[model samples]
Target: MNNWIIITPEGITKSPNDTFYENFQVLGFVTATTKEAALVKLKENYSYINGSGFDEVWIYQLRFSNPNITYLGIEQEEDEFEDDFEREMVHKITCILEENCYTDITYDYFEEDSYFFEAYSDAFQEVRVDVKDETIEVYDRYIAEKHFVHFGDIKL
Candidate 1:
């Protein structure tokens, strides 16, 4: 049974966009004092990607002039202390990412368990649909934790 997670605009076909055709570490505005501050922040740091074939994702932050902290890029992979061969691979991926950076201070990382920052892209096509037609899931991690804490008296 493959667990599925779907994130789409309100009325999408309810398909999971989880499989990445391509991904990049991108950043956009979060909350800036002034519009100028937002622009400056976006100018210094942000995230984006071009192309396809992505399996995992991560999110992180970046620094810019006005000392503004902007959300940047979505990435995959894990570790950081990369070997030479890995470094070369990351460079290739970074090239693609940088080429697609419509924002400032963009970089890429193609390593194991990559660092991803939320608020990466500003492009989303929302899809809205009636929930009754889909098999939706309601999960609560807290409930699971409580179950283990008091395993004897389980309640449905």
Candidate 2:
């Protein structure tokens, strides 16, 4: 059986045009026999927040694999370390993550040229994954402050 998880966007709203705020909450996993079954459960539980035009629900396939490392293009010294592939890979990923300042940075402008951040137990690394209808919008903290209050739970 395949496992799937639904990310419910709690306290999510648009403060202005092209700007949105939402604290994504994990709604737990759903056991199903196929991808279609998982999606069916997602659609069944979908609900819209009151007076909130946002209706998109994000779902992901749960994988048990180790987190992937994103390789950001960074210049490395040829003799930095003697054949230390893991160290080299970690350094490159760290460089890309640092350049973005670690604030929900996303890159999808070009195919095979996009990046995302994933924090593991001890370090942060970049990973490549095809985003479905992925959008990276500017978060307006000022506007979010005035319109929303987080209650530490789903407000439904």
Candidate 3:
């Protein structure tokens, strides 16, 4: 079965103070064996149901036909553990620093399989690690100084 989504155009809602606000939101979604069935249901609901606050609604059929993708369905199995590469990188960096006599270590935000970490041994230094690529780079100053940039070339 294919998944379908119904999106409604932006509409205005008047608050008690007569203040109006607009929003574009999803009306609902459904699963059907065919796109025609989903479109029919979407039209029926929008025409005869309590769909009042919107000017227009659109129907989208979710296509999962890409060979490189696999859907996990709606259920997660017990004993299933997802691997977190970023956490592994943090742990590796922490262990390396501890072994090398770097103390007072801490880490900030993990995103896109990368994170910035800092450690002090009478001097402050920051390092960014990309877990997916197994690359580590050092920063000359505190992480706050270069929080916006992701590229650092000094490998460790």
Candidate 4:
């Protein structure tokens, strides 16, 4: 059996205007033959996932070869590595924001974009940075607001 990491948002969806921050929680690790089987095992064993209120969840296969690496068994608390995860995620976001001249960070997640940070220069603007893709998009807040209201669209 292979180990897998299960991740999901902390709670239900929030208002579009609410400040967005990364709050992904690692549900825990499960042993299964495949990713699909791992998810099935998690759903069957963990009641939290059934009522998690999240639209989706992600799973990553855990693979390591370092003989010196310590292994925290599956019985370890779920939050054991949460602080490190949060620090890394926040650092990446902060770097992206700083590199693009965005300060006083107020970030939020759009259903479409997953997560975005907002900052103002002369006028209100919404900045969406896709760290995985190494891409950034900036939009006028007014335009974003209008699009969000009329079309439920935030990506451009």
Per-prediction TM-score to the true structure, in the order listed = 0.22, 0.26, 0.33, 0.34
State the displacement of the C-alpha of residue 48, model 4, in Å, after optimal TM-score superposition: 2.2
Which lDDT values do the candidates have, in the order given? 0.29, 0.43, 0.58, 0.55
Q: Please provide, for model 4 over 29-64, each residue's C-alpha lDDT reduced to its tens digit, 9 standing for 90 to 100.
A: 677899999989987766555765765788988773
Error of 4 at 136 (Å): 54
- Writing each residue's lDDT as its tens digit, candidate 2 over 27-83 gives 435567776787676555433333345455566776742335565676655554334
- Name the lDDT of candidate 4: 0.55
**Best-fitting candidate, scored by lDDT:** 3
Clash pairs detected, candidate 3 = none
lDDT of 3 by residue, 1-156 (tens): 777876766665676569988865665555677767876775564453355655577777766422132444857554222356545666777776666666767676566755666665433457555554445654335422435344343334
Model 4 TM-score, all chains together: 0.34
How many residue pairs collide in each prediction? 32, 1, 0, 2
**Of candidates 3 and 1, the better by lDDT:** 3
Position 30, candidate 3: lDDT: 57
Show model 3 residue runs off by greater than 4 Å: 1-83, 143-156
